[model samples]
Target chain A: MTRFFSLLILLAVSLPAHAAFNIFATVPEWGALAQEVGGDKVSVYTATHGLQDPHRIEAKPSLIARARTAQLVVATGADLEIGWLPLVVRESGNAAIQFGRPGYFEAARFVSMLEIPPVLDRTLGDVHAAGNPHIQTDPRNLLKVGEALARRMVELDPANATAYVANYQAFAERLRTALVRWEKQAAPLRGVPVLVQHKAFPYLQNWLGLKETGTLEPKPGLEPTSSWLAGIVAQQTAQPARMVLRAAYQHAAPSLWIAERTGIPVVVLPFTIGGTPEATNLFSLYDDTINRLLRAL
Target chain B: MRTTLTAALAAVLCFAPSADAANDAALAEIRAQVKQMKESYEQRIAALESRLADAEKTAAKAEATAVQVATAPPPAAPAAAMSAFNPEISVILQGQYKNMKDIPERGITGFWPANGHSHGDDHSAEQRGFSIDHSELVFTAGIDPYWRGNLTLGIQDNEVEVEEAWFQSLAIGHGLGLKGGRFRSGIGYLNDKHPHAWDFADAPLMYQVLFGSHASYTQDGAQLKWVAPSKLFVEIGLEAGRGSTYPGTDENANGANAGAAYVKFGGDVGVANSWLAGLSYLQTSAKDREAEFEDVNGLAAQGLFDGTTKTWIADFVWKWAPDGNPSDRNFKLQGEYFRRTEKGELDCLDEEGVGNACDPAMSGATVLSNYDTRQSGWYLQGVYQFTPNWRAGLRYDRLDSGRRDFGVNANNLLVADYRPQRATVMADYSWSEFARMRLQYAQDRSMQGVTDNQVTLQYIMSMGSHGAHKF
Candidate 1:
């Protein structure tokens, strides 16, 4: 029995106590930012891949077990992950990383939000009460989130504070320059009329100064009714749009269906890092997004 | 005015000084009034210009928004914080339509103890046709930084029972967790979940034989679980429960009536497959447990049995989903095997006292018989989610009691070699995550010479806040 217990102890002692801390991010954008800001000071893991919808991924046990040992959890709060993240954190049983704890970081908390609902009801078809949670679509919001993440990493792993700060500063400077280049390169997209599959591109459109003509899904998260699709088709026929915009991770059928009938080109933008091959990091995410819009134009 | 001064050269000498002073003062008053008017007019002009500029800016914004709705500016709405620290509440309503050739005389096999059945009424299955299968009310919340709590109430007919109410420790470090209260034991994969969460409309026959119609493995107890830090998922759990319900009665002066221990390990295969395997052991001491059975003469016979029961179980599950997203296509295969052994004495006497040592005999005598029996059962099921919102599954259940002894029938015990087997097929469609409809057909051979053909239609609807499912 004593020997068996010793074996059990050996198994329990297998927890990784490496020099780098583990950071668990709920989405790809947060993971990319963590990697950029933390550099080698932390190892980052993304809970949901780019192809999967962040709102609908399953709270798998593998994720919970990984979260159990996470030194920090980065998520885009404002109830974006209301469907799964709460239970994942609760089941992780790690008090240090629960909501309102030092190890928990929400990117949306650092940036201003959009599409806030005055009155919230489920009848509105998945309206986020706090605001639209797709804040990372705008490059400016990414910079703000990166700064906050840098401070959090310092607090969690103070030994690497200097490295984290240096990395964050370098990344922030590069992002600032990229934002200017993107605005200049995407000038032709300004005031351009386009149709979107869903209302998820508010922040992206806001920055690019694009005008929204119609939406495939009349209501968020709800399949478009026949009548609503008819209405969009008729409306777009009366006033033609330049293109149909959709994210690389979004379903292609909706945008393609409209594009086929109206002859409007469809543009699939890389909404986050890893969403497309060209969008390999935070800086490239904007580059690929603007290039896709220009191609469609 | 100069002519007036000339009106009287002589009078002007005295009046000219006063008139000139009055004229100067009047001029000063006129100048001040003119300055005030000019200032007011300039302020008005400035206000009008600013208003015009604001109107132009707003029109430009509206036009910009109208150009491309793809990036259309959102209508300004004040944001209201909806975050609440209050406990999340959810209700699950399950209703089913069932048709069976005949109702079983007993809920479980004869060897199974009586307490496994419902406490208040033994005829819970009497209702036929359309019936409210169950109504479950659930509440979950974090009590504080150090703990969390969950309460589930199951309401059936006019009776309400506290199905589960437990508090779990959250501050325990090193992947250790502790839970205490009345809860379902973590012995098997399906045992820890409520009926509404089940893939099929009803429990498998093996689960019914080992537990009951409703899961009877739940009791007032404390459990401790440890998650190993291995690359793969590995966990060990132990539970101590008051076995007052089933094969074991309330504890005596000796100690608690029951004890249980289990260990589970899980790992992933490549990127699309995952599997879990577990082993469990349970032991309980019964003071006086009663169950009804058929005698050798085919007559109803009820008796009290006292013994120590031991059960061992092994379970395995494997799931494959392309891209790890079950939304499209997935397949799950699960199986569990259990063996139970009971040894003690049974009293078949219809007497005034409840004692296992006493037996029934003619001519004013009593005899006690050895209640030694060994039984084993197993179930295997496979479910395929061929498409979104659609799933089909098939399950097989079997049990064998090949060995049996009653001490040469010393107490006139009626022992027979009885085996039961069943096969079930089910298909379900879910409109959303909160609503589901299921159709199931089952052929049950639970009784010795009976094959019950049963069909059921079930709907489970959940509303309000609900937690995500555990992997």
Candidate 2:
């Protein structure tokens, strides 16, 4: 053990400085976006995977060590990570990622948010004060954030400014063209009544023009009481939703339970990048989401 | 309306151009008056719209502010949430109901007896009844950009004692961290953790023998740690403490009487398995540490030992989880071995009226004896989390009295080599991240002559903001 530690210390001391700028993203989508925008000039480290919930995490020291060396920190922000991110960044002691710095980029700030509560109360249940932070569900919002992130990259790494601008323009154009095609293809899904697992899919519902009738989780983080589930079942009996929708990452029990009772097919969408095998990147993320919804129908 | 007026004006122009120029001037004045009225109304409407927009913006900002405050649990200071300087406060509550065949006479085998701060006085001996255990209130916040301060006050039966108070540097660069004031020493695996964080209702037998009932290596001290920049987690830490707790006393820590150093490494075995191992060394000096013993007359006497103490510890932990997610199911196996050696002088004195024997240097009647002893202990524990909210664990502990030698004394006392062992089984359920209840059963043999069959039920609850547990 002594010999191993000694060698490790020597290697750490003797290693050359890395040429790649290191970026630490709070979630996977931003990590994917960073990879797309910064092809060879950066290395990205995502703090969370698709399956793990991002609200809370075990903040290990190795994560702090990684943050300590990070040049930029891209996060969903708007308190989506309010429980863990502030503590991690504070512990990292990295001045570059401190709030108000150029390297501190919040993707939510670049996009218009939803669900800004009209009145503040604990009764609201796990609501984000800065508005709903699950903005990546909407492809339009991701494009806006992508543009902002590319500009931030240029500000942080001025030498790669032209490359970043070109990358952003190309990504923006591709997304716009895809957006028109997706909207036209998804016209059939318009006005389709859908029951949701949680409010995580409201932006997606809005994008696809689906009418969300109710949610399995009446309040965030609260288990569905049988009484609450009964009310949804009654509604489904009257109006009869075409499908029950949920994110691939969420537990399927509640959605499956509702589907079994109501005979509504349950559809699992890729909520973010890499949520499913085919949802590998930004474009594929939406493609798989639409395909899954159509398959369920 | 405008076209008719224009045609009327055109007919009048054809018929009345020969009429008076004053009539045309009067018509122009009327048109100017109508135009001015319209412009005034348009400006007033624009002003009203601007005011409405500003009101909406202000309302939205207010809602955001209110919602942010509502997100956190309400604090004593209503303005505390927005105030950047408000300290983060957290409270931990622990309660337990214990049942046992017998509670021993408050002393650990092969070690010193209770000295006020023992398991006997607080929750240990209070069996067959519900007792509020050592709960704590913690306050922490950043002192400045460069340093963060923390204080934990232990609360037990209306008595509040300072458990730990320290300040740590945030920007010490080069994988280096520096801590000052009093903090838990980086010792064996479980030494630094509080009882609230323990897997069982009580500590292991090995910890009871090595330290007091509270298995803490905390003291007034300073520590420096370094993390190697390697794929594997490698860390080295060293501490210098005022030896004012168990294993040493306040009297012994006149200077830097305690010191420790440790090296640890951890890495993943596969996608779902990981392991960590560490080696630690500690040395301290104690003056007049007291324990109970039988004199030649078979009466209880106080034995004060002054000596140099040295200890070595090795710890290992292995964890496995399905799909790298511990929420559904996981297994953890951890073990630690400790060996301690001491060279000291024991001064035995009668209770109440010791006849100046309390001061060994002042009286010849003081039974001054020189002794050298070696003792070792080890424990292994395994826990399996069957679901997100339920877990079961089993632990075994062994202690060995390695070697003992005593000098010639007036009372003529000697202790035999003996190995003591204990086993414990526990199950716990967490209602949420903030609350947990545990049921435990143990067969302890830490006492020389008695076997203790102990059962305990415990609940630990945390309220307010708390930092994440370290891995």
Candidate 3:
């Protein structure tokens, strides 16, 4: 029995040596990015899936359990996770991944934010004080955030610093090549007027130079009503948009309703990794996004 | 260069006199001009070459530093980048208009009064027509690297009360947490939650019978909780407190008067459903716990009991949302069951000595007897969110009076075999996350055979900080 116990202990200690670094990602995009940069040196646990709303997540016990064992916690800060992340971090009881620690990395801090409200008010409907946190929509932001994220990983796990750097460089090189190709393919989408279901695509619009004609939601985070849809339809009659864009997680009812009246196409974009079957990884996410938009055009 | 050429021109002009002299002077002037131009070009070339050398040196220095930065790891981010300790302050404004029967001495029938001896105006009493509920002021902030503190003050008309004040450990590793001070005990699912988070305007009958009407089982003490490192989501916690509330009286004695322990487990089922269940136990002691009761002759009297009480609670909750997006639609089902057992001694005193049924031999004297009783109750509630800003809920609760043995003091009090129950339904509409208005109706039969139909219109508005609720 003693030998058996020793054997079990040995197995437990030896198993984690290869993939010893544990990363707790608040969203699927960060988890996918971390895996791309960390390679096989880290094991990641994503707290929310692609279909789940990041802002409305509950601080479940399962998330706390995953956070307790994590060496690093990567999130899209800027109050994008203001509703749940604070509670989860506090309940985890893991000091290493607390705010301002080396193990805490926020992707939004490394990227240039957009849609900063001129005034701070809750009356604006859940407006983030730090601006829009959907930085992953633009592939170029990924390169910048990935570089900083790699440095954070190195600081937390210095033993594998070289590997982290090499991995980031490799990822940057691949993504840079893909960015050139995606830009060339999406050049025709430039200056094309489109409607959005939610205010979730500023970075995407900025990258592709797509003209945002209007939003289905009357305000940010508010559901679209029939009157709002009718207003969009009336506006489309004068300055007609070509297509309506919606995220994979959003309900397609409103976008489809607008499309039906205006005779415009409805394009669904994988807003993050694993949002669609083809968007299973970082590169495929943008590839699938551009392909859908091009098809719609 | 220009100056030198001008000097040569002036010398040539000064020497010119006759035609032959002029020709010779002009040729010499041309030759001197050419010589001056050659020296001027040499000086300009030297100056340009020196400037080019300086530019090259600076470029080399910049390139060398760039190389150094590229080879070395970047400096660590500042430790205080996100550690600005700004306290989260918030206030909750709540008011309601209630329409119900006028019953000043309202008490649950067939059960011991929960308000005990210190009762004046019950805190949960809803005056007819309109009244402002408690306005709550909350402050929470990280004290340092190791602790987080929270303070909440409840304000009513001309009165202020400290509802909760506690400090929780932040840096306690190993999935362990420690909390100290006056805070609500985590004995039942809804016990620790504030009133604003409740779906209905009123509490369940089970809770009202166990504690007091609309009262929470709070304690002033310390608690420790541990979470297991497992995929199934297991947690265990224990608390020790000075139970100076209902079901327990302040004895002013040393040591812990109340103790509680609980174990909880939860997990998600696929992508659309999640569940959590827990079992909790509480043990407390009471000295001279007082309650008003009626005798066989229907006269007013009081009963004081000294006893040890134990309670057990089991709770469960299940939530469902399509694709895990609750903004569109969601549903939650929650329920809790509790059983309590008490053993003690009861002293019955005749007030005003006007009751003839208080045992003629024991007139003007306290009737002492051995007392023991057992009681149980359960409640189930469900809340449905059909839209992003609207929710409706229904709750049903029932309590069993169980059995009571009063020994020799049985004739001094009235004991009946009765079960009290209530059914409530409410709907609330939210303008946003910070504001909500609700309308509720309830059929309450908790007061013996008297059924009171109640309706309430309520509004709750939060200002400043946004709080994330726990599941």
List the candidate 2 regions with Cα displacement exceeding 4 Å.
Answer: A1-17, A60-65, A78-133, A211-214, A217-219, A222-235, B1-84, B114-120, B124-127, B251-255, B295-298, B353-364, B409-416
Residue lDDT tens for model 3, B1-471: 212222322332243334676588788998999899767655654454454345436534543443221121232243375544568889999888899988877777777888765545636445778888889999998888888899999998789899999999887555666788999898888888888888888777778778885558888887766666567777766677888888888878766787777778888898888888999888888898988878877877788899988889999999999987777789999999999988999988876566635544546878889989899999999999998889999999899989888888787678867889999999999877789999999998888878999999999999878568888
TM-score of chain B of each: 0.78, 0.78, 0.81
Question: Compared with the true structure, what per-residue lDDT tens digits does model 1 show for residues A132-185?
Answer: 899888887776688778778866775666677678767866766676678789
User: For residues A15-84, what per-residue lDDT tens digits would candidate 2 score against the true structure?
Assistant: 4544678999988899988888888788898877776666645454455666767788999987787666
Residue B396, model 3: lDDT of 94
How much is the lDDT of residue B90 in candidate 3? Answer: 93
Instruction: Give the CAPRI rating of model 1.
Output: incorrect
Q: Across residues B365-386, which tens digit of lDDT does each residue of candidate 2 receive?
A: 5577886888898999999998
Displacement of the residue B435 alpha carbon in candidate 2, Å: 1.6
For candidate 2 chain A, the 10 contiguous residues with the lowest summed lDDT are A1-10
What lDDT tens digits, residue by residue, belong to model 3 across residues A1-297?
Answer: 223322332332233322479999999989988998899999999988878777788877777778878889999998888888888787776677888778789998877778877787777777887788887898877866787787788666755666776787678767766776887889999899999998889889988889999999888887788998999999997888999999988877899999889999999888998778899889899999999999998
Q: Candidate 2, which CAPRI tier? A: incorrect
Give the Cα error of residue B188 in candidate 1, in Å.
1.1
